[model samples]
Target: MPDRDVRPVRVRLLEAAARLLADEGPRALTTRRLASEVGASTMVVYHHFGGMPELVRAVIVEGFARLAEHMAAVPRTADPVADLGRLALAYRANARANPHLYAVMFGGVPLDGQAPPAEEPVAGRAASGAGTFGVETFAAETFGVLVEAAARAMDAGRLRRDDPEHVSAQLWSAVHGFVMLELAGQFTGGAETVLTSMLVNLGVGLGDAPDAAARSLRAALDTPAP
Candidate 1:
């Protein structure tokens, strides 16, 4: 006879939830549906996450955690701008690979305006039983990776002497805007070409020498992401 799967219930629920969220939108994440997907009873969802709101929050947290892992894997080089550019590429790739999860992570449409309903005091305590931190903490920590990279670039004289937070925010906005547009089918031309142009422009705008920064970014793009 085939062996019974023995993975922990929480892990199984999370994996099933992620797949369901990706395939169907947030609305499809009913407790019954999750339980059905994972071949478990509805009590399993409650036993693990307390309720749907907590489960959805967990899914978003897991998504950001994966994104952070992808960005963290990017190798840091002497060329901070290039490194930043490569990180941007990685971000785009991650979003593409997990469009539905990405949407959930970034509060995209359908799920965009819908904030998770607050848990009742009893439910909150039950949810907190898992000892999970707030989602914003994870998100801020992930964003700090970019801010630190920007600081490194400025310190190395590769970029202009600007507030690292401001620089990081600007770069993030530009890259994120492009990714959103591309995902929405707004780009008529090659998305990669447009991305390269945008990165080059960003480097030129912030770097001490326009030519050197552009060359460095172009070279960075040529190298495969680690």
Candidate 2:
């Protein structure tokens, strides 16, 4: 071999931690266990993350970054409502894809009322007139994307004219609730269908353009005489 890559080792460690967090829960995370899981020595884990708290934060940040990437990947269509729907579906899919990482990114670990380890400062404007993370906290990065999309929808006249900030927050809250409950197995109905219906109704209230695109797609499918 042309020499093994060290970077992949660190990445594997982080990926292991994220999976452990989602599958077993935060309490189960430990450097020793992580090292064993990744087939690396305990010293390697320390070298990569310094300590447990820092490692926790890195994993959480990675989780959020992945979410932001997914949100960014949602296709941009001229129709803002359709775009938002795509974004919403993407959000749920990510959570389902990485449940533990999602939990850690959201303060899933019981830290005795302390905040989960934050790897970096939230990047945005703070309410105190100081600039902060605004909504750029790695954990909630997806929420930021949703807020921005909501505002774009309003600006494009696809959604109703409302407070973008308020509507964005509300929309995020609803979607998060659905994901959380579904993860907890609280929803007996399939989460996929439920979430789609939820977003459709939410679009109606939030100002999705008339169902023209959906109608057109359906019509195209219905036309059979090739």
Top model number, lDDT: 1
| Candidate 2 local Cα displacement, residue 158, angstroms | 2.9
Alpha-carbon deviation at 95 in model 1, angstroms:
1.1
Tens digit of per-residue lDDT, candidate 1, span 1-226? 9887698777678767766765676687788988997789999888877877777777677667667877888888888888898889888878877676676767773553235555344333322344544566557777888998899988988888999999989998998999889887898989888998888888888864778777877877886754
Name the weakest run of 10 consecutive residues (lDDT summed) in model 2: 126-135
Q: For all the candidates, what are their Cα RMSDs to the real structure? A: 4.3, 6.9
The TM-scores, one per candidate, come to 0.81, 0.75
What's the number of clashes in each of the models?
0, 7
lDDT of each: 0.76, 0.67
Instruction: Report the C-alpha displacement of residue 103, candidate 1, in angstroms.
Output: 0.2
Prediction 1 global C-alpha lDDT: 0.76
